[model samples]
Target: MGIRVGTRDDAEAIAEVHIASWRVGYAHVLPESVLYADDFEPRRRAIWSEWRFAPTQRVAVSVDDTDRVVGFAAYGPERERARGTTGRGELYAFYFHPDVWGNGAAAGLIDHVGERLRAEGFDEAVLWVLDDNPRARAFYERHGWHPTGIAADFDVHCELSVPEVEYHSPLTVEGRP
Candidate 1:
């Protein structure tokens, strides 16, 4: 697999990975209705189509031998700013095709993301994972992320929410994780 900066042309492929990963990875944590929603793919495509990268915001994707995106990671300046912390970034989203799990594509994307965030002058980075999604949480942990004891309910739709815990890692060390 190869890693590269995502472009507008990759919107559809990224959406495919996003939807597929959510469907399989969150199958147990989220309701089937939400995961398999009829409008999910279209909505994802639309969202990705509107994605734009900036100085502190960017996305990287992992592609297979055929150059099809199989995983992606989106990151930028932390959305939920914390007092006294200006060098913190946030891993807004991370997803990979279920079939690519355990193949190290996710690891490659994450490493590239970390290097970019560090080069951008971010000292640390944060990400939220569903509290019940042990598989994902473990993956983050294995990559040097640790829970920050910060928990919140992420509301997806009307009256539907899921608990998520924050994880953080220092980006000061080059080639770390």
Candidate 2:
């Protein structure tokens, strides 16, 4: 498997991974109606297409040996203001096919994003995970991320409301160019 910078042509595949991963990962936490909606894939595809080309964001995709996209990560400048310190970069999204959940694809994708974020000059990064997702929280923690004790309610598809917490990690700081 290999990781690469995402392009416009990758939007559909990335969206597929997003929906498939969410269907399984958020099965118990999100509304079935939202996850199973007929238009979810297409809508997510459109959003990803635009987001992949955004100036301030970086999107990375992980592909299998056959070159099929199996996972993706999106990170960029922090969108939300931090309460106590200067806002850090954020991992806006990260997902992989359910089939690859335990096969190390997710960890590889996170490592790739971390490298990209640090190269972009960010010293720290943050990501939000559903509070109810112990598996996901543990995964992030194992990757050197820790909670900042922040929590908030996330409304999905304007239908399901779930609680989420933030996790943060410091990126390896290279001497600035």
Candidate 3:
């Protein structure tokens, strides 16, 4: 597999992955219609708009030898309320499609963002995942992230809301070497 920066033409596939990930990742927490709604066109358009121009963000996608993007992630600098980082730079997001769940795609994602953040002089990163998302929480913990016991409100589908658990890592990736 190979990874590269995302572009305009990738919006459709990106939308597909985003939908698929939600269907799987949030199976229990969220309503199925939230992801599998009849308003596909609108959702696609919205994702295209946001994912295309999100600030301080770069969406890196992984593709097969045939150049099919299987999974993607977006990471960049942001404020870290969880890391106690008032001025310290932070990476905001990282995600991979379920199809590539254990295939080292997630690791490649962090490596990609880490390179960019490091080059930008940022030595740490922060991410907030739902507390009940054990699969993801365990993944972060394994990657050397530490919980800050910081819970914040998360808005999903504009109608549903939940609490998020915060995690942090320093330049050395903390516990993992």
Candidate 4:
């Protein structure tokens, strides 16, 4: 697997990963009607098409041997409302195609994103995950991200919402031995 910066041209592939991952990952936690909606792909594609990465924002994609995007991570300066100090970064979105779940692509993306965040001078970072998603929570725990106990209800759609918890990680300073 390889990791690199994502571009506008990758919007479709990124959307594919987003939908596939959500379909499998959130099957139990989220409503099937919303996940299987026909407009889901188009909506995601539209979002990716218009996404503008801020100067401090970084988007990374993990590709297979064929150079096809298999996973992606979008992060940037921590947004307001998250419980964190200054100089913090936020992992806005992360997803991988279900087919590549156990192939270490996810690990590579997390490490790459952490390095990018540290290089940007962020001392720490936070990400929101579904409170009931054991697989994702465990993955973050194994990756050194601990829950901050900050919980919120994430609106998945009109009249559909779920609980989420924030996970925090302190990015090692660059040049540290």
> TM per model?
0.92, 0.91, 0.84, 0.93
Q: How many residue pairs clash in each candidate?
A: 0, 0, 0, 0
Ranking by lDDT: 4, 1, 2, 3
Q: Could you give candidate 1's per-residue lDDT for residues 1-177 as a string of tens digits?
A: 999998878888888888898889888888888877787777788878875355556889999999989999889888854334555888989999999899888888888888988887788889888999988999999989999998889876557899998899998576443
Candidate 4 lDDT by residue in tens digits, 13-128: 99889989998999998888899788777788887877645566678999999999999999988876645455688888989999988877898789888888888877788899
Residue 173 error, candidate 1, Å: 2.6
lDDT for model 1, on a 0 to 1 scale? 0.83
Lowest lDDT sum, 10 consecutive residues, model 2, at 168-177
Predicted structure 4, TM vs. truth: 0.93
| Residue 43 alpha-carbon offset, candidate 3, angstroms | 2.7
Off by over 4 Å in 2: 81-87, 173-177
Pairs in steric clash, model 3? none
lDDT of 4 at 38: 83
Q: Which pairs of residues clash in candidate 4, taking residues 3 or more apart in a chain or in different chains?
A: none
- Model 2, 59-109: lDDT tens digits are 899999999999988889887743544457789888889989899888878
